[model samples]
Target: MSEGFNEASGSIIVRDLIQVIHEQRAYLSEIDGAIGDGDHGINMDKGFTLTARRMEGQLLGMSESLKLLGDILVEEIGGSMGPLYGTFFKKMARVSKGIGVVDGRVLEQMLESAYQGILTIGDARVGDKTMVDTLDPALQALKLANSAGRGFSDALDAMVEGAHAGWQSTKDMIARVGRASRLGERSRGTLDAGATSCYLIIKTLAQSMKELSK
Candidate 1:
């Protein structure tokens, strides 16, 4: 197999992301109900559905598709999630601007860029019961695996594990940001909506890249 996926695979990648979010919409909203507005899934579906429609019949490279998704999320979607995810996707697209094929190393860079991008706007940190709970550890694991000379598949698996662990960690955390923060101890028993969604996003990216690597 090649060391990377073709940059042209972006359309399919984004399409699968839409599918994943759509399928998990109800579950996401349910999780949010524990301490949040219970509309994270609804809003996410709205933005991803729009992105899917816009990508039809267009032959976009990975960066182009990612940029389009970021634009739609930033401009059309409302709430804190809009800007956070928009920055993440946009940063990934920016870092990948000139790449023809996206390799494991490039993917590591993209993930780091996305993580830092979120931190730029969101004040959330590890154990904050936010998406950073998922993203930060995931990036760390990916970086560690890559630095250890792990292959693409191994590094991707490591990231998946890290993200899952981070997502789970949110369940034990006191909500420290957003609406959930108001719930205090009530938020401890449930998974964070943002963290759950973020986990799905990371998992989807890893799965898609794994498939494309073949």
Candidate 2:
């Protein structure tokens, strides 16, 4: 198996992430509409697309690209998603500083840091049906995979699967935080938009790295 992707290839990889967000925008907003303000996809797509445009014609390392993405999300977008996801990516960039390649261990650290960063800014907990649901489970799964001596690809697979499961789990849960929480029992039976978007982000990251591994 390929060891991992070069950190320098982040420019292209980040664009891929933006594309994934763009494609999922409508779906995300639809889910949000069921419980919250219904603008999750639109807001996320706007930020990610704008960031991709700003990074065009530039060459940057993975960490630099991630920081740029985070900055754009925080500065350009409004609403909870902006600050939450912005901080998440920024923390990921922080932990990845000076890395030559993003291997299993490096990716694990990045995810863990990103998760903590979101937690620092947001009070969401496990089963709260927020992005934390997807993030925490994915991070834990990746950590477990790393501990089991899995290769980067295998570990990434574990992370994605865990994230998907976590996202799905939100459908059975009533929101305990955020705007959706106002709905109380009404929030049940629908997926949390934040968790859905978080899963997409993890899946996009894994797919982009897999492309670079080839």
Candidate 3:
């Protein structure tokens, strides 16, 4: 039963997120091509890479790093995802600020804030084949695990599983929001690009937190 990671050293978590987004750029674009403008990956990669460049040689804590990333995304990235994800990270940063140990409770709070922030800016919901599909379930799993007295590491594992399951669930859903909605039933067979990227972000965060807990 590990407690949690040090917020000061957690900048690596953001770095990992940037790396994953860059690595998955092509895949994300391909997924978006099925029902979007096919630029999700490119746009995400550009924003995250720029964040990484700005973060180089900095010794910021997790909250600071998240805020920086969020700011960059909002200010520099294009399209709807920019504002949505920017709000998500910024909200998480607010909850995480000054937390010494990012334990299960703190993580839950951060995730809830991020989730609510997304809801505030976007109309997307669980069945909408959007990032909300993955984010909401992951937040619920973390919250449920923490409430059940699970260890921090276990809670993170639960969050990852929930995110993965939610991402997979998107394949069977018809788009109810975004450009994909125009496809109607045609959107059912493809995975939502936003959901996939959201899953990756959650998965990366969970894994990084698990490692830091050690």
Candidate 4:
């Protein structure tokens, strides 16, 4: 059987995600400034920082930690990001609630749930130059890799690659949703802030999963 990571120790993955968001907070804001209200990173950092504080000294399992983060994002944060990311993590938590190990199949299921959850909350589509662009591709890649019998680490690598490519693809897309959509063709030159953040989150998760699998 393929190797998997213990769900009990997977809280570290959430910690790593928080660290990356904190580190890239300013950069994410910069990306948002180009076409958004310029508060994407700031809001994200605030919520994630709060999550970190709330989790301090606590050793929760992956599902529990995800639930905490999701609840905080939905309750404490404002703007569209709050609900969007909250649903994302919450759906993931639901999928992984009782799993002993997070193997490729479990990870794929988690990604699918998160992706679908986001879709249910918004009207964004693949070419809409939204976070869906990054998330959809990543989920598809992971699903493909898992179905093909690839190792968990390799499937994660594929997921990261898909996310990065999707993120990059947003730079040349005319925004079809969000405030950036108001820019019309002018939005084509800048990267979508949501897509960029989605890419970073997926990349961090993939990296953490790879290490845990090792």
Candidate with the greatest TM-score versus the true structure: 3
Q: Which stretch of 10 consecutive residues in model 2 shows the poorest summed lDDT?
A: 5-14
lDDT tens digits, residues 98-170, model 2?
A: 7888898999899888888888899899999999999988999999999999888998999999999998999
Q: What local distance difference test score does each model get?
A: 0.90, 0.89, 0.93, 0.92
Deviation of model 4 at 32, angstroms:
0.2
* Per-residue C-alpha lDDT of model 1 across residues 1-214, encoded as one tens digit per residue: 5577887765677887889999999999999987998999999999999999999888888888889989999999979899999999999999988788887789889988988998989889888899999998899999898999888889899999999999999999999989999989888889999999999999998888888989
Which candidate has the top score in lDDT?
3
TM-score of each: 0.97, 0.97, 0.98, 0.98
Model 1 TM-score (2 dp): 0.97
RMSD of each: 0.9, 0.9, 0.8, 1.1
**lDDT, model 2:** 0.89
The parts of candidate 2 lying over 4 Å away from their true place are none
Residue-level lDDT of model 3, residues 42-96, one tens digit each, is 9999999999999988889999999999999999995999999999999989899
Worst 10 residues of 4 by lDDT: 1-10
Superposed Cα deviation of residue 171, candidate 4 (Å): 0.6
lDDT of 2 at 37: 85
